[model samples]
Target: MSDGNAKKTSSKESFLPQIFYNALLVGIMAGISWYAQKHSVTAGEFVGAFASIPLPVVLFAMVMDYLFDTGSLYRKVAGKKGLTGAITALGVAGFFFITMTWLVAGTITMNFSTITPVIYVVAGLLTLLLLWPKTGTTHFVLLYYIAVQLITKFAHFTLLGGVSLG
Candidate 1:
């Protein structure tokens, strides 16, 4: 007779490919975040677009996890493949942040220049660092969207000359 352990092992193996698929989809959605800034004309549009993307991203990540037959925590902290996937996901999230932030800043009577793209990159990184650990996929996506909008608005007002403080 066969041991029970064999059946369990087979089950686990079967499930992991699903997990990998989920993670990849998450990465794809996160990557899309970068594009929002270009399309946004107002803060409402920015928030709307940013709010909408993460569920699909997370759903993809979940599917990838199932496909890979891996656990979330395990893959999140494991070897090279895991790390690479996370980084790609983060990159997608970054794009979303930049797009939404630009939208909000435009609403506040601020002037945005081509250089704003550089600022968006930098701010996106900082927000990700702060929010990623404390928040899961959904919260991280939503909060970053909001944070980018407000912070960039304040920064534009304080540091830039477009508003003409004088």
Candidate 2:
């Protein structure tokens, strides 16, 4: 095969793995949530609740988060010549919070004070560890797990009328 064809084929092959990985992550999250809900609610109720959620909204929120994160990281790594890194990071953080709040609507209440310290500590540790060499994938997976937890909590609040705030 020509060099151009080989490059195209390699990129296409790489894309499939990423899609499969994301699908697997979603499936695992769904399975765990289903099992937890099944113990408290009937199967029909669980199905109804799951079916009521707007998939597009959830996907859009996730995609926005992913994009903001990528942009912030890119700025930090490639645009470090000035205050661009800090500005981009702050903007991305604000955007993420705004997007998450919009996605949840008024269905969930969050007590930021109660969780702020824990979030800071965990985030700090993760950031430090992720800065170390060869830890990017592991840290990303951990972050994804945190994202899944938040998603599950939002789903519960929206679908099952669960109290999310302490």
The TM-scores of all predictions, comma-separated, are 0.26, 0.30
Residue-level lDDT of model 1, residues 1-166, one tens digit each, is 3779888876776455445545654554464365445644355543443333333332333343343233454344322244465565555455545543443233322445533343443334333432232233334434554465465553322222222221
What's the lDDT of the predicted structure labeled candidate 2? 0.41
CA lDDT, every model vs. true structure: 0.42, 0.41
Q: Give the TM-score of candidate 2.
A: 0.30
Could you give candidate 2's per-residue lDDT for residues 88-164 as a string of tens digits?
44454445444443333323346443332222222322232322223443335334434544656644433222223
- The candidate maximizing lDDT is 1
| Model 2 Cα RMSD, 1 decimal | 13.3
For model 1 the local lDDT of residue 144 reads: 56
- Model 1 lDDT at residue 4: 90
